[model samples]
Target: MKILKINEEISIKRSVDNGTEEQRVVVKSIIERVRQDGDEALKAFTEKFDGISLVNIAVTEEEKREAYKEIDDDLLAIIQEAASNIRSFHEKQLHPSWMTTDENGTILGQKVTPLDSVGLYVPGGTAAYPSSVLMNVLPAKVAGVERIVITSPPDKKTGKLPAAVLVAAQEAGAEEIYKVGGAQAIAALAYGTETIAPVDKITGPGNIFVALAKREVFGDVDIDMIAGPSEIAVLADDTARPDEVAADLLSQAEHDIFACSVLVTPSEALAKAVAAEVEKQLLTLPRQNIASQSIENFGAIYVTDTMEEAIDTINRLAPEHLEIVTDNPMELLGKIRHAGAIFIGRNSPEPVGDYFAGPNHVLPTNGTARFSSPLNVEDFQKKSSIVFYSEKALKENGEKIAAFARLEGLEAHARAIEIRLRK
Candidate 1:
C-alpha cells in the first residue's frame, strides 16, 4: 500500500469495464444464438465453455439431495440461519399497494407489484459463494416474486453446482436451479430456452463475459446494475487496530486483481502501521497472488489533516464498502453521504454484512454508490402509478390539462383530455 497526503484532486475511480469490442461482439452473438436455437444453443455453449455435456440443463431433485448430503450439518444450519436473517431483514422493506382518494373523487397512489419471475446468476469457478446465493434469492423471495430461479456453472469434474450454493438456494426458498453459467447462462435467462423460462429481471455477479451479456440484453429484460470489481475504504483513527483494518481490506482485495482497498485516516502513524500490517498479512492469505496484485495496483493509504477531511475524501470516492473505525464512529455516520454500505465501529467488519448480517451484500461498485444502491427487496418489485380520474375531477381540471398538453405541441394528448372532458 502506498501512503500519500489527501489532496482536493484525489480520486479512487477505476475505469468501468464495459468489455472490449471482441467480447461485446461475442456476447451479442451468443444472445442471438440463444434467441434462435433456444435450448440447443444453451447446451452447446455449456459444453464449449464449461466443458461438460448435460443431459438436463436443470438441476434434478436427486442432484439437490446429493448436494445436501455433501454439506455438513453445522454448515447447513448456518446457511439456514443466514437465510432467515436475510429474509427477516428484506421482509421489512416490503410495501403494500396504496391509494388515496380526493374530495373530488380522484384516486392516486402507487401499486407495488413483485416481478413475475427473477433469475439469479451465481458465479462458479475457483470458489463457491453460497452467501451470494442467499443475498440474491432471498430479496426476491421477500418481495413476493413467484419464481426465483438460480443459474450457476456446474463444476467441471462432477458436473454439478457447488454443494454449498445448492444448499443455500434451497434455504433461501428458491427451488428452480439451473446448471449453466457465463454469457450463455445470461442469454438463457434473458430469452427463454426450451427448458428455462425467461425472467422479468436478472440479478447477481459474474465474470466480464457475464457482465457484457447482461449489458447486451438489458433493454429487453431488466437487469441489476453492471457490477465492477469489489472495493473497500476504511476511515480510521489512531484508536483503530492496524492488523484488523489490514485484514478487512484484504478481504475485498482477495476477491479480484482489480479490487480496490483504501484506508483514509488523519493519523499518519496509523496509516503507516496499516500499510506495514497489510504487507505482513498478505503473506498468509491463500489468495496472496490475487490480493498482492490488487494491493499493488489499487491499494492506498491517505493521511488527512482531520477526520472531517477524511470523511470528505471517502464521500468523493464513493467506495462500495466503507468501514468507519474511529474513537467515535457513530458521530461521523451522518456526514457520510456516499458508499454502498457503511460498517461502523471496529466490530462491524465488512464480512459481517457480506455473510451473516441481514444487509444485502450485492452492492454497487466502481464509484456507482454516488447514484446507485445495494441489491434489495425494491429491486425485485415494480411500482405502477395508480390514476383514477373521476368525471367531476376531469371536468374541473380538463381545460388546464388540455392547454398544458397543447403548449407541448402534443395535439393528440390535448384531444385525449378534451375528449374525456366532453364525455
Candidate 2:
C-alpha cells in the first residue's frame, strides 16, 4: 500500500467499470442471438460460455428438494434467521400508497406499486454466494413483488445448481429459478424466451460481460445499477487499531484484483502501522494473489494534516464501504456526506452489513456512492402520481393552469385545461 500525504487538495484516482471492446461486442452478439433465436440461443450460449448443455432451462421442484437435502440443517437454520432479519429491516422501508383530499375536492398523492416481476442474477461458476441470494431476493419479496426469478450458472462438475444457492433462493421466496448465467441470462431476462418470461427489472452483480450486457439492455428492461469492482475506504485516527483497519481493508481487496482498499488517517504513526499490518496479513489469505495485486495496484494510505481533511478526502472518494475507526465514530456521522454504508466503531465490521446486519450489501461501487445507493425495496417498486380536481376547483384555477401550460408552447395542454374549465 502506498503512503502519501494529503496536502491542500485530495486527488485519488479510482478505477472505472470493467469493459473491453471485445467483451462488449461478444455480449452484444449474445443479446441479439438470444432475442432472435430464443430458447435455442440460450442453450447454445449456455454450452459455449458455461460448458453445459441443458434439456430444461428452469430448475424443477425436484431439483429444489434435492438442493434442500444437500444443505446441512444448521446452514438452513442460519439462512432462515438471516432472512427473518432482512425481512424485518426491509419491511420498515415498505411505503403504502397515500393520498390527501382537500375540502375544495382536490386529491393529490402517490400510488406505490411493486413491480410485476424481477430477475436476480447470482454468479455461480467458482463459488456460490448464498448471502447474495438472500440480499437480492428478500428486498423484492418485502416490496410485494409478485414474481421473482433467479438465474444462476450451473456447476460444470455436477451440472446442477449449487445446493446452497438453491436453498437460499427457495428460502428467500423466489417464484422461479433457472439454470443459466452470464450475459446470455441477462438477455433472456430482458427479452423473454420460450422458457423464461421477461421481467420489469434485473438486479445483481456479475462479471464485466454481465455489466456490459445490463448496460446494453437497460432501456428494454430496468436494471439496478452497473456495478463495478468492490472497494472499501477506512477512515481511521490514532486511537484506531492498526490490525483491525488492515483486516477490513483486505476484506474488500480479496474480492478481485481490481478491488480497492484505502485508509485515510490524520496520524502518521497509525498510517504506517496499518500499511505494515496489511502487508503482514496479506501472506496468510487464500486469495492472497488477488488481494495482494489489488493492494499493490489500487490500495493506499493517505495521511491528512487534520481529521477534517481526512473527512473531506473520504467524501471526495465516496467509497462503496466506509469504516470509521475514530474515537467517536458517531460524531463523524453527520460530517459524512458520501458513502454507500458506514461501519462505525470497532465492533461494526464491513462484513456485518455484508451478511447479517440487515442492510443491503449490494451497494454502489467504482465511486458511484457519490450519487447512487444500496439496493433496497424501492428498487423493486414504482410510483405514480395521482391528481384529482373538482369542477369548482378547476374553475378557480383554470386560467392559471392554462397560462402555465401555454408558457411552454403547449397549446394542446392549455386547451385541454381550458376545455375542462369551459365545461
Candidate 3:
C-alpha cells in the first residue's frame, strides 16, 4: 500500500482519484452486438461466455412458487427480517401525487409516476447476491413501480438461481424473472427480446462488461449508474481500534484486486498499528491473494494534521463507503459532504450497509459520490410537473412570459403567449 502524507488540502484532491477509460470500450462493443442481433446473439453469447446450453431463456412461474419450498425456514425468516428493514427505510422516501387550487381557479401540482417496467440484473453463475435483490427491488416496490422484471443466469448444475436470491426476489416483489445474465442480460433488458420486454430503466451490478453494457445502452434506456470497482474509506483516530480499522479496509479489498480500500488518520501511531494489523489479518483470510493485491495496487494510508483535515481528505476521495471511526462520529456527520453511503462510528461498517442495514448497497463508485447517489426508490419512479390555468391565470402571467420569449428571439413562442393573452 502507498503511504502518502496529506497534511494539506491541495494534496488530497490530486492524490486520491482514478480514471475510467478501460470500462468504456468493453461496454460499447457489447451494446452494439446486442442492439443488432437481439435474441439469437444473446443465446450464442450465453453459450460462448457462460458455457450453458440454451434449453430456455426464461424461468417459469412454477420455479418462483417452488423457490420458497427450497429455502430453509430459518434463513427465510432472516430474509423476511432484512426485507422488512429495507422496506421500512425506503417507505420513508415515498411521495404522494397531489395538486393545489387557488381562488384564481388555477390548478398546479406534480405527479409521481412509476416507470412502466424496470429491468433488474442480478449477478449470477458462481456468485449469488440475494442482498442485492432486496436492495434493488424493495425501493421500487415501495415507490409503486408498475413492473419489476429480474434476470440471472441459472446454475449449470441445478439450472436455477440461488435459493437465497430467488427468495429475496419473491419477497421484494419482482413481477417476472428470466434465466439470463452478463452483457447479454443487459442487452435483453435494454432492447427487449421475444421473451424479455424492454425496460424503461435498468439497475444492478455486474462485471466490467455488464457495467459497460449499462453505460452503452444509456441513451436507449436509463441505467442506475456506471459503477466502477467497490471502494471504502475509513477515518480513524486514537480512539479507533487497529484491528477493526484493518478488518474494515480488508473487507472491501476482498471484493477484487481492482477494488479500493484506504485509511486516513491524524494519529500517526494508529496508522502504523493498523498497517501491521492488516498484514497480520491478511495471512489468515481465505481470499488472501485478492485482498493482498487490492491492498498493493489501490490501497492507501494518509496521515493528516487533524481530524478536520482527515474529513476533508475523505470528502476528496468520495469513496463508495465511508466510515467515521472517530471520537465523536456524530460531530463529523455535519462535516461530511460527499460519499455513496456513510457508516458512522466504529461499530458501523460497510457490510452492515451491504446486507442487514436498510440503506441501498448499490452505491456510486469511482469518486462518483461527489455527484451521484446510492440506488433507492427514487430511481424507479419518474416525476412530471403538472400546470393548470383558467383564463385568469394565463392572462395574469401571459404578458411577462411573452416579453421574455420575445427578448430571446423566439417569435413563435412569444406569439403563442401573446395570442392567448389577447383572446
CA-lDDT, candidates in order: 0.92, 0.91, 0.85
TM-score of 2: 0.97
Candidate 1 lDDT over residue span 1-423, tens digit each: 999997777776777578788888998899899989988998898899888999999999999899988999999999999889989998898889999999999999999999999999999954699999999999898898999989999888878888999899988889999999999899999889889999999999999999999988899899999999999999999999999999999999999899999999999999989999999999889999999999999999999999888999999999999999999999999999999999999999999999998999999888889999999999999999999999999999999999999999999999999887776
Residue by residue across 1-423, what tens digits does model 2's lDDT show? 899987654533454564778888999999999999999998998898778988889998999999989999999998899889988999999989999998889999999999999999999975889999999999999999999999999898777889999999989988599999999999999999999999999999888888899999999999999887888999999999999999999999999988889899999999999989999999899999999999998898999899998999999989999999999999999999999999999999999998887999999877778899999999999999999998878988999999999999999999998987776
Write the residue-wise lDDT of candidate 3 on 1-423 in tens digits.
666797444221222222257656655666668778777777777788777777677777777778889889999999999999999999998888999998888998989998888989898887689998999899988888878999988786776788788889988988588878887889889888787779999998887677767777888899998777788899889999999999999999999888888899999999999999999999999999999999998888898888888888988888889999988899888988888899988778889889998988999888778998888878988999998888998888888888899999999999998887776
Count steric clashes of candidate 1.
Answer: 0
Find the 10 residues in a row with the least total lDDT in model 1: 7-16
List where candidate 3 sits over 4 angstroms from the true fold.
7-37
The clash count of every prediction, one per candidate, is 0, 0, 0
Q: Which residue ranges in model 1 land beyond 4 Å of their true spot?
A: 420-423
As for candidate 3, its clashing pairs are none
List of clashing residue pairs for candidate 2: none
